[model samples]
Target: MDAFSEELMRSVEEDDQEKASVGCGPEIHLPWLSQHIQNTVSHGHKGINFAQTTSICLNFIQEALLKHQWQQASEFLQCYFQALEDFNSQKRQVALQNIWKLGSAILYHHPKSSVETFSAFADRMKNIGVQNYLKISLQHALYLLHKGMVEEAYRNLNQAESWRYGEMSASQEKLIKLIQAYRGLLDYYTWSKKRTELSKFDMDGFATSAATQDMHSYFRQASVNLHEIIKIPGVWDPFVKSYVEMLEFYGDQDGARQVLTDYAYDNNFPSNPNAHVYLYKFLKKEKAPEDKLISVLKILHQIVPSHKIMLEFHMLLRKSKKEEHHKLGLEVLFAVLDFSGCIENITAWRYFAKYLKQIMMEKHLDWVQEGWSSRKDWWPTFHFSYYLAKKNWKENKILALEKAFTSGILLGKGCKYFMYVSKQGHKVQEKSIKTMKKFVMKHNILDSKEL
Candidate 1:
């Protein structure tokens, strides 16, 4: 029954705006405020006292300068923070988040760090406990990983995982498991150059298992991605290579290789160098003609000469073509020139440094004149494999993986290699996953998902 309401209604009816919105609301003026000041002096109200009371601050010299009174909008924020204490603690929490929005408007794009206000908010986060801990820790891990402090990220991830598990919920446990699995894959690739010897805690095993379980379903769902890879020359690109590698290790090389070859030309599979690793693995597993291995290496060199591992591939290639076993052995010997230094010698480190592709390609060849040495150790072997691959020191660029995987034979590190190598195993029918499998468990086998 205010005159404003009567006027607004009459205008709405006249303009047929009753059904349309103008997006305006009723606000009060001072004399207008006294008329109903008792009814509405809520924060946003513009009562009769509004102009006068606001002027009190405008009138003050020292205080007006504090806010650059020209930007009266900023004062709204001071009023906002004051209003929050009136609510109970829970609503007080929400008020703090809104405080950001309030500052966002008044800050006029000047990056204002309300450190004083944020400190209180941060304290609230700590008070909230476990849920907040997991969220904050996970975010921190993401930050560390983004900054390339992968080790720090994993450490923080461990803290987050602990918090999640402490919640004692099976659902939460699965979530943590999946996330850990994700981190493991990243960690494995990030540490691809550290193949000298795995850490005491076994980060290698952790990575492989995570990929196997979490990503097994990815093969089927990843078909679109696989098709893109097929467009590349050589039936094997990273995806196909991984698929074929996995199948062959599952005890079916011929079958995998056949399927891979069928799709080889259709999918633009690189028959020469890209497919060399699977071919070599298959050639070794099956008693195929040695000439086949030599042909692959020859094709490898023709395509890429910078391959540092060409020497190692030469060992296999020369031997494979030789009809007589004795002649083959001799040729293989000369092909592999014995560098005078050792397991950890600067010479070996040179190859390791030469090949480092981000993904593991292995060139672990550690020798000690007459005996074995740390140069051949699993971790360093992988580290160097990656290093040499980067240098393209071998024509059979992919063959660098041969020395890398084979070196794992000494310490039984083959399982770790198998995890990666098998992903591209030749046998598709055998290795092709039919449906998404749940991450059941983990073991030392390269067959399982560790990443």
Candidate 2:
């Protein structure tokens, strides 16, 4: 058996032994217990403690979930719901919050059930006069959108927009704005698809049709709403992206660029990394100058050094023949390895090796060696340096010997294969390799194996 299965079996056996020692009987059938508790709660069984029974059912559901017994857990969940149905109005409000948490965990594993669960939950919330029912509708709409049910998602959003639950509180007001933003996004999606369909058949006919007029009206409304929405500083990525797309489609390139730039520079918004990412992507799409792209990426890099896109930017910098650009590319690669969780990126390591080779080719040996000294703590430097030394041994014997010796000392047993001794048995080569092996034995760096 695989290690994981063996470990799981061991753990289960240990747990059963512990339970037996504690006088707990054999495992109860969770599905049967769940149905029994649910029947008792539903039938209003006399003398049954509601709180204690509810707690026990919830505990069984959690145990079943830990065991990955989804069917049994689902049964226990229904029993918990039945118990909650008996709660008084004030208690029901608090109980609804707990149900949302538990329901999210259960429903996430069962998408087919989630559709019914979300609908039923929304109905329950609305019947209770809960203001968050609108938010729930919006969440349901987003889920529908993810499932590619655009028409259904639009219906949900439209229904939510019509909701009038007394005076709006501060939180509800924000929720309304979010709902409107989504509505605008849905309109954009619908309009874009219709336009694509019409363009393929009769563009002139579509331009003057009622559908075109409706699309224009939708566009105007979305543009106005998104303008106001973005003016209030926040990370409004979807709204901003939709707004920019609509503007670009309508032949407003300058407007789109301005919107992207303004969002990236918005001081009121907490420094959002995506804000800068949006601007960088937009500028790149526009075929902006290298300097402009570099400047924007520099800011983004400072905000999030580990961002994956930084690697692409590093390649862009490497295209330039300028020494400064090459140096910048090296720095970018180092940052990506150090901070981006890409420590084992072979492409990056190979790129690093190539860059060092270029520097070694162009600069004086003393200068290159000085740079190597500063970066000695990083194993890739020594690892790649050894390969470079072996490849160019005939042209630069002195440099090759130095690199081989240092790499052996730092790389330990891993560097043994890279240590080449010619059949000619040059005394200098033999002496250096021997000294390198001695250092490898005495001062080995742990886990410095080459990639």
Candidate 3:
């Protein structure tokens, strides 16, 4: 078995042994975790106290996280709370904090769900006098800021500041400082009308600071001081992102490049795409030698190999008319399609797929077709959906349409193939449609007109 499954088994066994030592009726069984939960919910009949039950639930939640099963963990959390409804509010508060931690841990992996999950827990926990309510509020505000909900983030951040008015612990003080820095960063970005989209690979952002050279210098000093006071790392943290933005706003490309380069090479921190992308943009802006630019592009594609990176590589290769780079770009794109099941930029995926289709069809590259078709990691990306719908494969088209719906493909955002599937009066699962509608409305995408 895999390491994750082994760890899960170990935890489950420990929980079972603990229960057995307490003379609890039969040990909680799983793969049938729900059955164990049901028995626990029956309370005295199983000799399982609330503490033991909570231990099992928490272990299961950890296992789910290890497996990257955020949706499953989310659903199980609801079941856990519902089953333990008779428990006191204090216990629930503790459970909510556990849930919050899980939510925060997975934010980079599953941002939308993480944001939704944490927001729900924060709303409930804040009212119950949870000590870390401000910390939770800070995270929620960050997610809101990520989504470009500036007004909402401002309100949430202000509310957290109000929460800091009473007597505070050291950790609470630290959280307040972090929140204030974030508030300053947000205000600067909002005033300058800059967008911040935090992805798994690109968690940091550069804020567009105010106009006027003197004002810029003053604001930069204050931001730097706040960052130092909070002890926010100069790499991988939000403060550095804002600092980079300030530098960029002042046309200080060298300063921004230094920060990004240092972060990229920081062995103590994980490598992120944004660092490399920032460095690449710097090199490009400076009109650096083509060799240097290509080297950075290769590094980006090697690390990420995402649709965006691959597409960018392809464009550079085509622009430079380099056969080797073209070949490398195609290979990288094919490899990305071979393994990636959860591609984020469906539009970019579509673009590459369409480009490949044109090339393969014109050149009659049967080998290329065979290789791609054989790959097991077949996510029906937007292009795949387009291909299926265009071919008039009714069942496959519907399935692709439903997948797109779940991926939050806005009504007008999707390609013609998706619109064709949607107008067919085909019934997808109600939940998928509801999710799509909510995403559309949330992003105000319905106002977009289709030709």
Candidate 4:
């Protein structure tokens, strides 16, 4: 055994002793184990024996579970899954056996919550055998559907439908229903696309009749299947969206709104963010009352403050004349900036700077300074300064030029905005241009000739 394996084995032994003495199990320190596994797999360390490590980890997990240490067992399982992912890449046979063992363990302990996990394992075990083929097929079809491979998804589902499973469990029956739901979704997408194509061209009478019949057939399949499965919560979002879209496409605006409202406000269903997003978008499309739209967005924002559509919320607030609305709009922009990857988003920065400019013009200098100072370290300063310069050159010229020089220094010589500053410097008076050129050369921002 390598040092890591030996150390881990010693820890396991120490835990066994502690458990025997105290009549309670200790939680495994799994962070180190996870990190070790990742490092070993990533670096291809040959000294550590993974099979031995796997054996130790699995024994620890089983013991932890037997002692009613659910939390500890859960942690071990998470680490085990990480190891399994590594093994799947490096040792296929070991990974296959581990996948089976983990799946069996999950089925034995928590079958109810294991369906999704089992489906994921089954996807990995496709070349190997799965006892519950129907569940696997359903999951695979759903996977393909998400990837937009409609025909392949249909073929997978169709093959599963023809299978001769002797007796159906309740779970299997539910899988069949889900399969039908997906099939319906596929049909709806096909019909929608075909109708769009047919609308763009003029056809002869027979061709038009045939196309119409084909479109109707697809709609009938989608409608019947989706209607039957609409009440099945937890998996009804896609089906509901498709049904609402079909309703809207057919000019049944009332029906579409009703369906969206029901789904968005359903008490029994889990709180679904997309349900409200769907409602918000549909309401906006129908030009619903501003209050109604704001109400839905408020609920959604409370749930997920950093949702992408919060940009739309900000835009909506910007349209209002109320002072409170403008304040809320600025808050929305900051909220959007808090979202992941928005710090580097130029458009978000532009919105922030533009909104800040309005506040500056209103003589809210304190608020503008606070906002600008807070994000000065990382916000795209050049964009903001450029906007200010473009809008009012006399007042913001020095500020813009200074920001451009600093941005170029920090971002390196290849900074694109630096060139803009260099060009704009020549347009200034001789004294100001000379001062700016000296600052640029001192920083070595660009060559003198390029300037």
Candidate 5:
């Protein structure tokens, strides 16, 4: 038995009779597991064959597990462990892939069993160095997060960061950043409601705002990504706060409030992003805001006092050291709401609205609705209420669409102002110009001139 051919030893050890699998052997290939047992199954000798092929057995099992072939994985596991008594350290290290797969399978497909499998993986990981293990660790962290294993995932992320030296590629770094972003953002009020951990991996790639805002940016479709990023556990709070301040400095009140209220609310809530989103669309339709969203939001305050964006702006400015933004906030709000949505930050919106209206009782800027009847280029988002309240929406829809386009053009132009907003659910830019043209034609206005 000791004198058996090396290849024969391999085959004999594996108990696989597919002689065709024979690497460099003199014998015909044997495929049937039973035949290997029969040919080499002399009772005493049978167990030795299984021992030598432990690596192969484990690999087969692991592949099955990764593929979600749970039934096959179970069978492979049975066979693999039966032969485990003889596997050496070298064989074990060589079989790490399978071990990782098993860990992943348990965590993702069979959560109740994951604790044990993950413990096993941990032991295996300790024996290994940080080379290939980092990737596995990162994946494990992501899975743990998904399974609501927050602390474990946090520990793993720290460890993963340690391994993130100068060796990783840019793509790998980006992926790691995404993982951090994903893990950080899960702490938002919305996601925490279920007490479920967010996935660490960006399976949908929504974590880091892309280099260029795609169809899913917060800037384009405010509410969704806004909601997504604020909850993550990373340094999201500071990042969002700093970012909103920057938008405010840049005169992007709509942009800032989207961050403030929707993504991460500061104490002075800007109002839900919908207020900014809808009101901006109305102003933008009239070629308003004219590249300065801050000024645009101000005028919006003049015409529509109860506008949510201006309310948030008033809150932010109320604390301004310069007093410019604060005074401006009141002026704009007074002009826009016809004094409807007033609020004293030192007091609150309720008392302020009442006092402001009592102070200036001329009808709210109901006159701003004058030219809405002549609205020419509003399509795609023609909700029934839109046509019913044409003046209300004419400026909002046009400006909203323009800001959407400007954001894209700016990103493509590689402005210093890229990534100021999260871009989620932004299907405004179709990949195919032809498709957009066809859509435009289908929604042609009554006048060809409007087209």
Candidate 6:
């Protein structure tokens, strides 16, 4: 399994590299820009003069350079740079934006690039100004940290830190604080590294595990770090979910519940599904009574009427085998159908069909249609086919087979079973296995391989 997992990871990484390589290259948008320029000229627009034309042309050149189309970019700069450079201040600012944006793009998308590319980019940006240079350095450090080059990241970050006392905009300050918060989290994760009692293994190529020697101490430290970040303006609400996860990780059920319950009271609370899932898991761990479980599920269903919660509710009822629980499961299926069309989610329809079969078999039900039940489009056809084959084979074999085929439900293994049962030659039927065979072949529903 480990070997298979490693191979899968490598396959995924190769696929990512392939995608990144293809994505880094230029996309041709010159035709669109030409059309725009023609439209502006036709409109008799004087403001869209040579300077404006030069600006747009320079923008295109920047894009070409970013994509490593150096020859095309050079040609464009030679044509337009002289015209653009006539506006001294505006030209420098535009150049700065182009270089910075391209640097960010290359760092993010082109992972095959060496660290030396970053150093060269950093040196080029130094001519922009002191504050902007420091900002780029911090960003570079963060990128290094992401690549697991911790020592290099720290050194770069320290150098940036020494220059932090200089002038900075509000937005820049906020970004720096955000990076510091991430750095603190990284430091904690690094310090707490151990193999035992970790979170579940990651199948994806990113994080592998969250290991720690002391669970309690680790939770305390993580909580402190996260809370401080949370108090900062503009930090996302989802970060609070991590603090709740910490409690759950330590098996502190009551603590996790209290946090979720309190958070849910706020008017602006984010309808985070994971919070409800964790609460449900806590309820299960405590072995709460069935009523309490249902109550929690009701709240969960109310907030996020997702397929997952409904499926869990159905399974919980199926496990109990109580008549009321079965009825509740039926209602839950109706709710799911109402929320999502059967075509939108085939899996949910599949589950609903299984539940329908179970109820029909156990109760020998004769269902009557109300306004809602009249919607035959929402019916679980596969389950209906199975029910007909099981219950009415002797009474009306031909009709049963016809309904099953028309519904497009019994084409696979389901059809195989119907064939088996029909071959047994039960008493009270007008039709035989031979008739069913004709119907299957006539419609060409299943291939010979399927049979």
> lDDT per prediction?
0.40, 0.65, 0.57, 0.63, 0.42, 0.54
Q: TM-score per candidate, in order?
A: 0.26, 0.67, 0.43, 0.52, 0.30, 0.52
Best candidate, lDDT? 2
Q: Per-residue lDDT tens digits of candidate 5, residues 139-207?
A: 767667667787777777666655645578765665566555444443322233321222232455544
Could you tell me which residue pairs clash in candidate 6?
A: none
Instruction: Tell me the spans in candidate 4 whose CA falls farther than 4 Å from its real position.
Output: 1-131, 140-156, 159-168, 200-207, 228-230, 235-238, 267-272, 360-451
Model 3 agreement with the true structure over 1-451: per-residue lDDT tens digits: 2232244346546765876799866632334346556755686656776676767777776787889876556545544443224347677566656656764565445534344434544565454344768877887787787777888898998888778456788878777777777777765564343232222214454323433333555455446644453244344455566666767766787777777677666666666777778777777878987777878878778788764656666667645666566556556665564454634344445555444544444453443444444442333343345555546434454345443442223233444444554445535444544544454344422232331
RMSD of 5: 21.2
Sort order, lDDT high to low: 2, 4, 3, 6, 5, 1
| Cα lDDT tens digits for candidate 2, 1-451 | 2232234335435654776799866532223246556565568656668776777787877887788666667667655654545547565455555555565566656533545445554555444435557777787788778778888888988888778777878888788788888888878777777677767657455355776677777788788778878988788888888899889988999999999989998788878888889889888888988878888888888888778888877887877766677677767765665643664454565565455445545553343344445565754553444445455466655445554544544354565323552221456677765654565455433335543
Q: Which candidate has the top score in TM-score? A: 2
lDDT digits (tens) for residues 97-176 of candidate 6: 55465545544544344565556556556445444665677677867877789878866765654555546778666656
Error of 6 at 106 (Å): 3.2
Error of 5 at 449 (Å): 36
What's the C-alpha lDDT at position 289 in model 2? Answer: 86
What residue runs in model 1 are displaced by over 4 Å at the alpha carbon? 1-228, 231-236, 249-252, 259-272, 317-451
Per-residue lDDT of 182 in model 6: 53
Q: Score residue 283 of candidate 5 by CA lDDT.
A: 45
Between prediction 3 and prediction 5, the one with superior lDDT is 3
Model 4's number of clashes is: 0
Question: On TM-score, who's better, 1 or 3?
Answer: 3
